[model samples]
Target: MAHKLRLTRKHQVALTETAHRNLKRFCDESGLSPDHALTFLFENASSVFHEETLPHRLRAFKAALAAQET
Candidate 1:
């Protein structure tokens, strides 16, 4: 089971080719599909944004994955 919330946004930017590829690789490495991985991230974003813990690790993980695509 999962909780759902309304997430309002001011603007939406479609994913770039590089970003899509990077996210796909990250998802694959993490054993998740792109959609599932995104859902997972948003669900836990509160912990990530408010808490001063683990965001650096998450950023590093994303950076490493992004680096692979470049």
Candidate 2:
């Protein structure tokens, strides 16, 4: 049986311009509203982390943001 998803929590996030653009593109291509896409991603995030280079990519992403803040 497929598990039903419920959006039971909310948090605000600041997205980089590139991230925002990519998210918009993904939403358009997938025909999912941003809310549904985000909810689905959150529910399935473990799969996302399975990409071998994701940890490296995450560090680079964080470093870039830190550089912007400095």
Candidate 3:
């Protein structure tokens, strides 16, 4: 159910090691390649904002990145 896009747009993003690992895990669980997974998630990202734990999870992830920068 992933990777149905034509892929006309290309965006490059940098991820921390933790994020890279998390993405790999998510793609493995969902049976998606990284490109397809990114496409699917970008398209569906709006839905994530409605999750009950979204704020907490976002803060936790950001805090890790912030800590690394300091």
Candidate 4:
């Protein structure tokens, strides 16, 4: 049987109005709750960092730029 994963940690972040609006827009477009979206991003980052061929640092920078464009 597969167990559902749960995140119990809490974090507080400060965002500018524009950043918050962008995050909200991304959440709306992807149909994900803010918590889930953050979880997904962290999971994706983990995978990216584990890759061998591409430098993890470069990939992370690219991902950040892509996220900003959304």
Best by TM-score: 2
Tell me which of candidates 1 and 3 scores higher on lDDT.
3
Give per-residue CA lDDT, model 4, range 1-70, as digits (tens). 9978698887897887997897799799999988877787777976734577558767897999899999
lDDT per residue for candidate 3 within 2-70, as digits (tens), equals 955587887898997988999899999999999889988888988845778888988998999899999
Question: Please, what is the TM-score per model?
Answer: 0.44, 0.73, 0.64, 0.55
Clash count, predicted structure 4: 0
Lowest lDDT block of 10, candidate 4: 45-54
Task: Rank candidates by TM-score, best first.
Answer: 2, 3, 4, 1
lDDT of each: 0.74, 0.84, 0.87, 0.81
Candidate 1 vs 4: which has more TM-score: 4
Candidate 2 per-residue C-alpha lDDT over 1-70 given as tens digits, one digit per residue, 9 for 90 to 100:
9977677787787897998998899899989888888887777898855678888998998999899999
TM-score of 1: 0.44
lDDT of 4 at 29: 94
Q: How many clashes show up per model?
A: 0, 0, 0, 0
- Model 4's C-alpha root-mean-square deviation from the true structure amounts to 7.5
In angstroms, how far off is 7's CA in candidate 1? Answer: 15
Scored against the true structure, residue 30 in model 2 reaches a CA lDDT of 85
Better of 3 and 4 by lDDT: 3
| TM-score (C-alpha) between model 4 and the true structure | 0.55
lDDT of 4 at 36: 79
